[model samples]
Every structure is written in structure tokens, then in C-alpha cells.
Target: MFTLSEPLASVIARLKAPAQQGQIGRLRRGIEKEGLRVDPAGRIAQTPHPHALGSKLTHPHVTTDYSEALLEYITPVYCKPHDALAFLGDLHRFSYHYLGEELIWPASMPARLNGNASVPIADYGSSNIGTMKHVYRKGLDVRYGRIMQAIAGVHYNVSLPDDLWPLLREIDPQASDTAASSDADYRSSRYFGLIRHFRRNSWLLMYLFGASPAIDRSFLDGKPAPDWLEAHGSDTLLSPYATTLRMSGLGYQNKVQEQLKICFNSLSNYVGTLRHAISTPWPPYQALGVNQGDTWQQLNANILQIENEYYSDIRPKRVTRHNETPSQALEARGVEYIEVRCLDLNPLLPLGVDAAQMYFLDTFLMWCLLSDSPWIPDDECDHLDDNRRLVVERGRDPAMRLNIGGELRSVPERGHEIFTELEAVAELLDILEEGSPHSDAVRGLAPLLDDPSLTPSGRVMARLKETQQSFAEVMLALAREQAEQFRREPMDAAHRALLDELIETSHRQQGEIEAGDEERFGAFLEGYFTRAREPRAARAV
Candidate 1:
């Protein structure tokens, strides 16, 4: 079984393992003195808030994004260059789960805007939560006001190759001198990181849809809107920045297409997806020598000034620039790696995932790649979008239809086809990892596909409605289980500390950003998008 440990010891140990002995000693002693609880509820609950923030009862707008985002990004399973996903192994047998943090914003505020201050959040908020911060279930659109720290999901990732680093900047770097001395900002660096991930790892998904209101409701005991409903559950409350599209009104073909056009307006898209057949970059552009020197820095500064001037959030503000960049990992060839985005925070399993779940995910991904989906046709491009909604709202409904081969077919039947294709994938992984999670994870998908109740999102909605508890309550129960898991399983030093630090910093950042101030809001949108463009330390360094 995979090892799990308390954040205090586990996380630090992992990050510091390669550090000097003195640093390691300092880290260990700090842990001993601080005494990692991993018991957030015990600690967090005790730290009472007069405001009583966070809720399982997500806001209408929040639910709206949840519903729509899922439709755009989720897929049944991603595989190829990402076959490692299938190698997952046995989940902790349904036991006392050690749920991680529940990233949330203050309950009183509208979920639309994030506050500058870190409030007491649960999971991964850009607040502390048990999950990954980058995996926010919500959209990180710059137009959405300031950047809110939350769990990132399928929407905020990319996968590509190492060689794609030099071509990340929207404009050339030869004009800027500081570009040499100062580190490449995260936006440029990580953009390349994303490219490498997509190029090298390849991804697959179970559903194309992301978090949806209807899907969230489906999981509840209460009846929700049927799966057939096609609409953005979010209200028409547009961000002030929505005007960037010059939308006279939200036109279907025009606006959607417009958004798509702008979103893909980057160098990489034309180079990669458009040129999948080529071995090297297309019609190769000359590389800006890394040592272009001081001239490049001056040019970059001028570019930064221009970006700051025109780029504002939904709310306008005086120019306040962010010092955005990635944490360095170049020493080890950068931290560009796969981000597992589709998995929901399983209420049934603690640690937000299981052996079977992980295994299934891995195998499913293998099948996803091996199934050999063609370069998606323009017409079929929306299939991934369709799957997101299906999985979120109607994931468990037997009648749910998913788009496959350009057709909307019921979840079960289509799932059977998908799983059938996956059998080979599972076998491959079984061979590679030798009885790893991939086999079990792939094998388990059919049951989830066939039995709606078995799905994580479905179970959450069910528990909330039938038990008549708030989403908060549902999460609390899960958290309790997860906490127990944390206690029982004993996390490694790195993982545990990562979790704890994420929680603490999440909270701290929540305090800073949740105020939803103009500067904070701008930061959220700009920072997220900016980071999206940059390179990870490995390639650039």
C-alpha cells in the first residue's frame, strides 16, 4: 500500500530529504516543537469564528460555475503519455477516512468574488484545504474579478514536452534585459511546463464536464434538474470584464466561439495540437538565445508595464502589479508534471481518493490514450464540454448520455464500451506496476458507470439531501473520516507537511485575498492567467 503520513512530519521530510543534514535537523525539530496535529477539525473547529464562514450549501452562482466548468473540462479518463495514472493501487479499504481540508470562502459573501483575507477554509482554497491548491473546482477566469485561491481542476492544466520552453512568451524576450538576471516569471515558465505536460504525459478523462449545480444536486437525496437540461447554471451576472468579448449579448455560436478563439490565442496551440504530426516545432521560429543579456530585461519591463496598464479585472483599479513567478525546481529539471484533475473529493473515501479509485483512474487513463481518439474534430470539440456536465450532474443517472463517436449515448451503455476498451489498458498496467491501482481502478469504473450511487459526486448529493444536512455537514463527516485516516495511516514527512502547510497558507492567503478587494481580485485573475503562461523552473533554468 502507498504510504500516508501526518503533514507536520511527512511533507517536510519529503521536501527536505535532499537538503543538508543541518536543514533536515532544523525541520524535524521544528516539527517536534510545533507538534503536527493533522487534526484540523479539532484545531480549526476550536478556533471559533464570529462570522461562521463556509458551507456545504454552495451558492447558486457557485453551483452554476460548478455545473458549467465540469462540462467544459472533465472526461472519463485520460491516458497515454500519462499511462502512469493507471498504475494506481488498492484504496484504503472503506475504513475510517482521513478527509483533508475543505477549501471554502466565507458563507456570508457572494461566491463570485474572493476576499483578500484568508478565512477558515477546509480543502484547497487558494484557503487551506486537504487537496491541491491549483485544483480549484471553480473557474479562474481573470474576468472573474480578483484571483481566488481554491482547488484547481481539469481547467487549469496543460500537458506537453520539455523542448517547448523557448517559445512561451507571447512576444519576444530579446527586447527585455531583466529577463536574463531576474527569473522568468511564472506565467511564461509554467506555460511551457503545461506544454511539456500535454506533450509528454498526454491526458484522458472519464467525463468532459466539470462541477455542475445539477450534478451536485444529483448526488444529493433530493431530486434535481434532469440531465437533459442544457444551460449554464450560473446566473447571467457577468464580470465587469466580460465586455472584453464585445458581447452585444451572450450569443451562442458567436460568443462561445469568440471565447474559444481568445482562450486558444497562444503560440503553443498552433505549434502542438495543430501540428501533432511533426517531430519538431512547426516552421520553426528562431530561439531567443537564453543569454540575450540586459537588453531583454528592458524589453520585458516595457511589456510588463503595458500588460499592467490595459489588463484589469472585472473591477477596475489603479495599476498595482503583481510579482508573479514559479517556485524554482530547475535543479531537478523543473517540477513540470501531471496534475490529476478530474477526481472529485470522494465523500465515501478518505484522502480524497482510494486504491481502487486511483487504480481505476490509472487504467482508465491508459485506455483513454490507447483508444486512439483522433485529433478532435471542430464539431466534436464540444464533446468534452458535454461530458463535464454529464458527470457532474447526472453522473450516476442510468439514463445519462455521454458524447462518444460524435453521438450522445447513455452513460451505462457508453461506459460499457469505454470500459471494454479499457480491459487491455488494465492488463498493460497490471504488467507495468504488477498488481497496482490501475487494474482495480479500471475494473471499478463499470460499477460506477452502471450504478449511479457508487459515484463520489452522486454519493455526496445523496448524503446531503437524504440526511438533510448542509453540504458543510456532509463534508464534515467526510473530513472526520479523513482525519481518522490521517491519524491511523501515518503520512510521510513530505506529504503531511505539504497538507499542513497548504492548510495554513490557504488560511493565511484566504485572510489576505478573501476580502475581495480590487487589488486582490485583480491578483486572482491576472496571477492565475499569468502563471498559466510561464515556464516551470526546470526547462527555463
Candidate 2:
């Protein structure tokens, strides 16, 4: 029988009490979607960023990721999921107006990359920080091929209110004891606990929502394709039972990263290990060197050029202040929120993700936070890695078995167990919201497990088969369709005005930053690395 942990059961009961039902509006969320700018021929566009969009470095809403062509849209934090998605739609509408004949590719896996030189690294202007950003991308091109960096996805950021934690601590006496620490420290510790549990159950999310089961052949970049992947045409590859090839070894895989053992058992250990990596030089990267003549190729020969290079399915995050590193910000302010990084762009949706997915995420994360999360030993961490690889590669295979607590369980059976627990959490959410959105979203997953063909990956594959089209062809069609839909729907006048103002403001901001620099680029780089190596100290309240 599936059973909830004692603390979870008690919290649920208290949350369902008559007095607390309508007070659950404290969950805040934000969304970030990355899309590649592509030409009408379905190739990644080599054109410079559109002038109307302003500077990629200073733009508040729209910015570039690794490639200048990869545009990332960020929404302001919002209490209601619908409002956040609506803001995303507005950003898209504004983008389409300036795209001319170009279009934003609608899939998580990117359009074709002809070669290394074809992908342009983003330029942020003449400031030292701006140059550092460009050099980091150059280092990525050296370490991992630019082709791998081109893959795009959606990130969902979420945080619970301060009021909810005290209630949780009251129900769990063990948590109450930790109240001796400052609220910031307590919250950071609890958020790390949440992260550990999220890692254990994250595979279930891949099974439910993973959509990138196929990709264009050119993404392979002339390398031999894996045996399990079948060619659909001269230009496309398909996987029969794959869920998210985007998360597979073929996607963001880096052989060198395997050596770094990053632990999430506590905030101190997590920060300590990452600090070591940033300082420790790697032999392979050292051979590449930091610069060739006057041109800077990378920041340093360290294992990671910066903290952002360490990619994972989810991350504990704190918003950084000006000139602060990610680690510095975390040590100072604690975990303000978490960024869920594994979601693929559901090409069928105009905003990449919809409200139903958002509701499901909230329930799933709550389950992760409230569940009994034991400390993961080294061997179990290896097992967790294996399980994630299995699901991302072949999750839809009915006979596939996963390692759950040393017991082998069929994927569907395990999925059923997870959903059963999730449904209970969904009911609690429904009681909190005075409606059934969360409950209805949980119930909707039932058909997906019973009939694999109903899953997002299944639906994508089915469409490919029925249309007799390559991945690129199908994705391009969807992109055009979505573009037309956004073009026809009237954009909010206020949002249009906001976009214009932001573009002008970003341009001025970039100019100001470039002109205000006093330190030489070399001295600035030295100072930044020096600060990164400093011991962790809590910021004064």
C-alpha cells in the first residue's frame, strides 16, 4: 500500500482544516522559454539580433542564452499561472512583429546547425563583464560542441510563501528544533531537502510530460547516430519509445562532468564543492588555454568556466544582486526559489507550456517537499543517475523496469504508484483553491499511462507518422501556425507600449555600462575570480 510520511499526513490534514482552505494563494511562479530564431528555410538564422529587440545583455524580458539566435523570454513572478503565461504570449507577439520573414522554432531540439562557425556566440558589447560572457560561450564551444548548446527548453521557477514553512515546522517537531537557526538558514536547509527528493522522483515527470522523442539528423553534426535511433528520412531521426532525447546522453552529455561529485545534503557542502570546481584547473581545458594571442578563448582553465555551466534537472536558486556571483547570493540570502530545468517546449501550445502543466508541477513539487527524503549515499546517487538515463531514453517502453528502492518495478506500475500519491496531493490543492484544476490535471494523467499513445511524445510521434513528415517539417509547420495565430490575435496595447519602452531603456543601459568601466579587463577578471574563492559568510541582516 502507498503511504504518506507522518509529517506529510499531518500537514495535509491541517491544510484541509476548515480555517485554512482559502488561504493557499501564496504559491508564486514564473516561466522562462528559450526558442531558436530560424529562417524560412528552417535553418538557424545567422542574422544579428533584431534592432527592435534591443541589447540582449540589458533587456529585462528578452535575452540570449548560449547562441545569439537562441532567445530566452522571462516573465515577472506571478501568483496566478494564467497571468504568467499570458505575459509570455505578449512577449511572443512583440517578437513576431520584428522577426520579418524569420520564425521562432517551436520544438525543444533545435533546427539544423550546418557546422561550428554557423552558430554565433552572443555579444554583449565592450564592458569587461560583457566580454566575459562571450568568452564563456567560446569555452563551451571548445568543451562541448556548439551543436549540443543549441538545444532549448522551458524553465519553471517556483517558491512557497514564508507563512507556509512555520505551519510545516509546527506539524513536524524535528523541523521545529531547527528553528534555533535564523529563518533564512532554516529555509535554505529545507529547500535543499526538497531538492534531494525532487531528484529521486523527477523521472516520473519525464514519463508524464517529456516530448522530444525525435530530432533532425543534422543535430548529430556528422557523428555516428546511436543504434536505437532510426532514421525517418535524409534529414530526420526518430526513437520508437523515447520520451525526451533532449535529456538523454546524446543531448547535454559531457564526459568530464562525471568526475565532479556535487552533494545536496546541505548548503555548506554544496557551495564548498562548487567552489572547488571553479578553482580547480582541468588538464584538458588547461591545454586549450585561456587565450590565443590577444583573443580570449575562455575565462580560465577550471573545470567550470562559471557556476551556470553546471547543468542539472533542477537547481536551488537565489536572485543575485549586481556584481554578486550565484554562490555569493545563495550564501547571503538563502534559497529564494528553485528553477526546474527539464521541461521541453510543448510545440502544440503557443506559450510552450500551459496552465494544466503549471498546476501539475505545483502539486508534484509540494509532494517532493513534504515527502520523507532520506540522505542519498554515493551508490544511491549513482543509481539515481542510472534511473534518470533509463527513463529519458526509453520510458514509454511498456516492459521497461526502473530501480525503485532496490526493487525492480515496471514503468507503468511505478507510474501508477506515483500518480496515486499525486492524486491525494491534488485533492488537497483543490480544497485549497476551492476548485478542481489541480485535481483534474492529476486525473488527466491516467489515460497517458494506460495508453502510451496518449502521451506528448506519443502524440508527437503519431503526428510525424500520419503526416509522413520529417521532424523539421512538422516543427516548421507548427511554428508557422502558431505565428499566424499570434499575428491574428490583437496584442494588448499596454504590453506593446511596455515592449517599446524596454527596448529603448535596454539600449541606454548597455551604453551606460560600457562607458562607466574604470578597471582593465584583465584586472576585472582577476578580481571576480578572487571573490569567487572567498569563504562563505552570511550577509548581515
Candidate 3:
């Protein structure tokens, strides 16, 4: 019953050609997953990063995030989603061999925290680059507190095949009219369009995949719980109908960032806004000071320490070269891919996500790209944020309604309309496959729109109710269970050997980097900011 936009319908018709199938099958994706390391009692581990796991500063695959206890695993890009997941699974298995009794916390929320001080900031080493990383984290410690930095989630990185660009450009109305539509310009514009559409509709992802509905009382430190939250047990706080508290105000929200209206209509606009934020000083951060005596406090007194500090649900990305900032990379080579940063860890799965979910994500992302997306103005941006907040806090409410185009509509009704379009995209993708896996993934998850209990967050809440266990207790049990299963499964001998070699090489690389540094830290810091402050011209397509 859903009506496809004229642009979308035209693209689908063209994509059905025999010559386009190969390009469609060439999509690539990668995953970056973060998990907190905790002891058997579910307390955040106070130990330094395990030595056998390799140097966090130089390791390509294994590293630390905001805290030493927060382990981040990265996988290289793969054509098939399952292959990427297999690599992720191997990382977990290899780490378990050296983790001893420690377990990786399974949920998006942090494990039982002692306080802000208990969350140790990550230490990278003595190199200038290492020092910069550590100092940047300290800035986050002062800006948002270490407790919020301890929250973990999954980041999915994906890129359409290069060969598909010419096909899209041929179909683009604007490109057809323009005389100078370079490959770089067209790709970036299409990515921004995809991002705009994603910003407007990513709430659907939270409703389906969000898993952090409850948290341990200790997560708030000594602060009182908000009225919206109800006590689930002596030590657990929850919102009965919430989907992802990890994405709500209770989690990573910052008042200062809320004021930053970062534009996504064009690549230059995005770069310019980010540069202004990093270069402009804020009063509160200025009070903290960049240096105290000989000890470094932060990178600067700006609104953001770096581009990475500016958080968004989705981001246009380009892999940066050595010493080049992210914006510089985009200005030089345009967007290479996009990263989806709003997904919560599904504690029900050992890897937090599965093949079926990845298939659905691929379908949904394609639908966003194919849909007709207009540039979003500031007022409309605010409305999108409001919609996301509503779904995050009260998504499972039976009578919840969303303000779609100023008209109020029930969640199920809107969800079904979107899914109908998704089903069409799925069929297009499944053209060359033996089974309709992509279409099957879309159809299988469609029922969750009407049945809230079938959602991950709902399943977690049901577990808490049936077991009468606190949030920490339930998560710890899952962690232990998953850890045992990982240990029992045999890792590929070749993969294990590769990991072993990487551990030694990572340590050596860090040592060489520290020894090779001759530039003063202050000079390097100044040069870094100078490069970031360079003016960017509007690169609109």
C-alpha cells in the first residue's frame, strides 16, 4: 500500500537491468564494537589493559576507548556481512585466552561503577601522538565526566561499490543538468542526501535493535533518578516502555553540543561547522585551562577537543592520512563511506549483532539512499531530534504517536508504510541470490512493529521481570555464559597465529613511535589546531 516517490521508482526500474546486478552485489561493510571489561562481581575492572592483548595505542584491531577497561575491537571491511562477523567473533575468542577471569560486559550501559573516579582514563604511552590521545580523553573527563564515556555501543561502517556511482549519477536529475559533476562531488552529495534521510528516519532502528532499557543504580553515581524511571529492583532503574536509555538524556547528552547546529546539506557546510566548533572557545572549558603547572589538562578550551568529539547518529566519513584531520580528508577526496553510530549492543547475541540484523541494515540503508531527500533546515532538524527522543524514552507505549510531517500517526502505521518500501528494496537486492535472505530479513522483523514484546529492549525487560534479577546481575550472567561458550568453541589455528603475531608487532610499533618523536608536545599541539582552523569553501553539489 505504500507509495514510492517518483525518483525512487525510477531508480528501482533501472536497477532491475542485468548489467546492474554485479555492482549491487559489491557492497562492503565493517564493524567497530566496544565492550567494558568487568570482574566476576560485575564491578568495572581497575586493572591496566592486559599486556598479552597488545598495545592499545598501536594495535590495528584491539584498542581502548575512553577507559582502559573499555575494550574496542575493529574488523577490516568485508564484502559479506557474515565474514565480518566471523572476524569479530575471532577477536573475542582470542581476547578471552588472555582475559583470565575477566568478562566483557554485554550490554550498552556500563557495568556497576564505583564513581567517576573509579572509571580510569585510558593511557596511550609517552609519544606525542599518544600524549595527545590521552590528553583528549582527559578533556572528555572534565567536559562530560568519565562515567558517560564508559557507555559502549556498536559502529557499523559501510560503503557502496565504486562502480555503482556512475549509474546513480546518470539517474540523478541535478547531475544531468549540471555541466561539472565530478565523481568526487557527486558521491559526497549522494552521501549527504543519504545522511539527511537517515537523520529523519533512524528512530526506526532504535525501536527495532535498541537493547539498553535499564541500568544499574550505580550508573548514576550518587545522583537521584529521574521521575520517568521506575525502580526495577533494589539496584536497577528502568523505564518500563523505554527502548534505548543509552541514547536518551540520561546517557550521552551534552548541553553545549545541543547548541551546535552542524549542517549536513553539503560537505563544505559539515566541515566548516566542525572547524568552527573545535576552534571557538567556550567559557566553561576555558576555566578548566589547557595546562596546569607542567601537567596537560586538555587539548584546548574549545567547544570540542576534536572532530571525533562532535557526536551524531550517522557521519559522512573518509579515511584520513597521517597527520591529516577528518575534514581535510573529505575536502581532499570526498566521502568514502558512512558510519552508523547509534546502534545499541543487543545483549541477547554474543557479538551484539547477527547476520539477519546486518541484512536488514543493508536494506534499510539502501532504501534511505534511493529515497528522495530534501535538504533539512534548522527547524526541521529540531523536529527530527524530538522524534528520536520520543522513541528512545517511550517507544514501546501501545498508544504512542509520532508527528510525521505535522500530522500525528501511530508508530505501527508509520512503521508499516516504511517497511513496505523496504520490502521492495529487499527484492531488488535478492535478485541474484538462491534464497531471498534480504527479503526474508525484512519480512521476519516486520512483525516487531505491532508486537513490542518481540523487540530486543522488550525481551530484556521481560527477562528482568521473569527472573526478578537486578540489571547488573542479569547482564553479568549473560557475560559469563557467553564467555564460557566462546572458550568452548575452537578458534581457527591460522587466525589465532595471526593474532599472536599482531600482539608482538603492536608492542614494537608503539616503542618505535615513542623513540622517534623529537618534536615538542606544545609545538605539535599548536600545529594540529592551526591545520584544523583552515577555512573551507562551500562544496555544494
Candidate 4:
């Protein structure tokens, strides 16, 4: 049996006590789900972003990710997970209303792509910032190609309350500090610790929730299918034991990134490493150049066009101010929350995700923070990568083994060990919520562990087998069904009104930005890169 450390056990005990029942209130959470807009025939939409949805640049809630067809919906942070999910549902309802004949593809892997030309990079009006955003996507097209960029997923942003950290510090005397100035740094450091632990165990998430075991053949372009993948139909390729091909090399995998050894040991190391990548030039990107005859191809010929390009399963995030880079925000304000980037869009759900999943994530993340996370050595980090690949590619294999701290253990055995700890955390959360929702969610995952066939990936494969449908056909059918369901449901009046107001305001804001640009585009780009390279404290000085 796995044992919780003394400090974590005591924290769990105190939180579960009756006296502390209502003290925690609720942890703050936010959701960002991305889906590709497809026509009734299920092909990627070639149409521009619908004007009714507001400017993809200025809109706070709605935006385009990499391709214009990829719609990203973001919810404001909420104390209650239900409220956060409700907001996401509302966004979907509003989006469906303006989609006309199009449907939001329910899965993370994209719909059929004719080729690179068929995938349109998102265009964000004429402002410098807008152009910067567009040009960055162009750079991605140049580096990674559009098909890989079109794969979409959900990002779950979560943070515990400020008070909870003080309580945590009290429990750990070594982490305790008397100065207010140091509080933010302490919180940031602790979040990094949480990140370290999350990377080590995130394979469990891929196994349980991963839903993309197969993909449309068009997603592979003209490349030959790997030997392990079998043709599901004339137009689709399926992986027998694979969980999330979206998390696999088929999606967001870059060879250049493999060399980046970004350290999560501390905030400084993490920032320094990413900053170095942004400034460092690479031969492949350099050959592409920043522009091809007057057309901007990318922002720079560096290893990274920006920090957002460095794809990872999780990220230490801080909400950025207008015109600020992500690294700048982290350096100035510290890490406010962490974003879980590995979750596949469960095509089975109308909202792409649900309250039960959110509850499980909350419990799981808290468990990660409470657990003892040792510093991951460079070699162990490589092993961590191996573990993720194994899970995503062959997780359902009963005999699959993973290296945990230099020891080999079966996937089921390791998963059970983690679940045992998660259950205890869930009970503590249930105590905090004055209900059993958290515990219920944890118990819900038990059947999946016992019977691998019950997992989302298993269900996806089973649906394909039973129906004899291609990946696109199955996902498109679900997409059309979900669209109809959303269309039939009336939007809440308050949410409808709020969305309408945001649409009008964002359009006006984008116009103002276009009108107010005084600096030349070239100068603006140069200045932005220069400022991004400077240390935050030095820039302030």
C-alpha cells in the first residue's frame, strides 16, 4: 500500500474535520475547450470566422487557436466547478446559434483536411498585435504544418484559494515565511512542485480519459500509416490499443522541442530556459526566414516563435495583461494557476467535458500538490516522456509496464496505487463541499480501472467496431447530434445578453486598436521581441 506523507495526512485529516467543513468554500477553476468547425459533410470549414461570433482578436471568450476552423471557448474563473461548466455550455449554445449549417467536431483530432492549403491560418484583423498573432500561426504552418496544428483539446485551469497556501505553509515549517513579499514566490514555487509531480503521473489521465484512438486518414496527409495502425475504413486509420493519438507524436510533436530541457525545479530555471529558447536561433526555422518576399511566414527564426509554442501536458500559467508576453506575466506576478493541457475532448459529452470530470481533476490536482514531489533528474525526465508515450500508445495492454523511480511496474498496479491516494483526497474534498460529489467522481473511475474496456478510449474503439464506421463518420455523427442538442436548448437570457454585449464591444475594441497604431509594423515586431528578451526586473529598472 502507498502511504501519504505525515504532513499531507495531517492536512487531509484537518480538512475533513467538521470544524473546517465550510472553510475551504470552493477552489477556483476555468475551462478552455477547442473544437474544429465542420460543414454538414464533416469536412473542415473553409469559411472565415463567423462575424457574429465577434473579433477573434478582441473577444475575451471566443477566439481561434491555430486554424480559423479551430474555435476556442474560454470561461471566466469560477469558485464553483458547475458554474464554470455552465458558462462553457452557454458558449456552445451561443456558438451553435451562429454556426448556420456547420457543426463543432466533438473530438480532439481534427476533421478531414484536403492538405496544408485546405487548412486556413486564423486572421486577426489589422492591428499590430492582431497581425502578430496571425503571423505566429503562419510561422507554425511553416515549421509544423497545419494538419498537426488543427488537433484540438481542452485546457483546465485551476488554483486553490490564497488562504489554503498559508495553511499549507504552516503544516510545512520549512516552507513557512514571515514576509508578505515572499508569499507570491512561495506560492509560485509550490505550484512548480505540483507541476513536477503532475508530469510524473499524467499518464494515468491519458489512459482514463483519452478519447482519440483513431483519426481520419486526411489527418495523416499523404504519409504512410504506421505498421501498428490498421485501416478502419477507406478514409480512416485506427490504433488498436492507443488511447489519445492527440497526445501522441501524431499531434503537437516537434523534434526541436525534444532538446529543450526546461527545468521545473524553480520558477527562475523554468523562465530562464524558455527565454533562452525564444532567443536561440535554429537552422531549420532560420532557413524558412521571417518572411517570404513580403508575406510574413513567422515571427522569427528562433527555436520558438513564442512561449506558447512549447507544447507540454501541463503549464505554469499567469493571466497576462494587454501586450504582455506569457513569460513577462509569470516573471512579474508569479504563477497564478496551472493549466492541464493533456485532456482530450470527450466527444461523448455535449459540452466536451462535464462537472464530474472537473471534480475528478480538482481532486487529482490537489492530491498532486499534497504529495511529496522529488526533483526530477534529467534522465528521469526522459523516462517520464517514455511513460507518457507508452500510455498513449499502448495503455490498454494488460501487461504494459512503466518505469516509476527506476522500478518497473504494470500500468494497472501503478494506476491503482495512485487511485488509492486520490480517493483519500476526494473524501477530504467531499467534506469541504458538504456532499459526496468529489468522492462519487473518484469512485466513478474505479470501474474503468477494473475493466479497461470501460475507458473512453475503449468505448471509442468499441463504437467503431460495432458500427463499422470511419473515425470521421463516428465523430461527425456525434458532432451533428451535439449541435442539434445545443440548438434545441434555449440559451439562458442573462448569458445570451452578456454574449451579445461582448460581441459588440469586442468589434469596437478591434476597430480602435486598428485606428490607434502609430508605430510601423516592422518596428513594432522588433520592439516586442526586444522587450520579451529583457528580464522583467531589468525592464522595470
Better of 1 and 2 by lDDT: 2
Which sections of candidate 3 miss by over 4 Å?
A: 18-21, 535-541
The regions of model 2 sitting more than 4 angstroms off are: 1-6, 18-24
Q: What would the TM-score be for candidate 2 when compared with the true structure?
A: 0.97
Residue 197 CA error for candidate 3 (Å)?
0.3
Clashing pairs in 2: none
Q: Report lDDT (CA) for all predictions.
A: 0.30, 0.86, 0.90, 0.88
Question: Model 4 compared with the native: what TM-score?
Answer: 0.97
**Which of the numbered candidates is closest to the native, going by highest lDDT?**
3
TM per model? 0.43, 0.97, 0.98, 0.97
Residue 386 in candidate 1, Cα distance off native in Å: 3.0
The count of residue-pair clashes in candidate 2 stands at 0
Candidate 4 per-residue lDDT, tens place, 283-384, comes to 988988887555798999999999999989999998787767888888887888999999999999888788889999999999988877878889999999
Compared with the true structure, what per-residue lDDT tens digits does model 1 show for residues 6-90? Answer: 3212322333322222221110000000001112332212122111212112211011122121101121122232221111111
Deviation in Å, model 2, residue 367 alpha carbon = 0.8
lDDT of 3 by residue, 1-541 (tens): 6787677878888987843446655579999999999999999999999999999999999999999999999998998888899999999999999999999999999999999999999999999999999999999998999999999999999998787788888777778665476788888889999999999899999999999999999989999999999998789999999999999998888889878887589988888888888989999999988896558988999989999999899999989877788898898789999999999999999999999999999889889888888999888888889889999999999877888888888779999999988988888888766688889999999999999999999999999999999999999999999999999998888778889999999999999999999998998899988877875442443
Model 4 off-target regions past 4 Å?
1-7, 14-21, 176-181, 292-294, 538-541
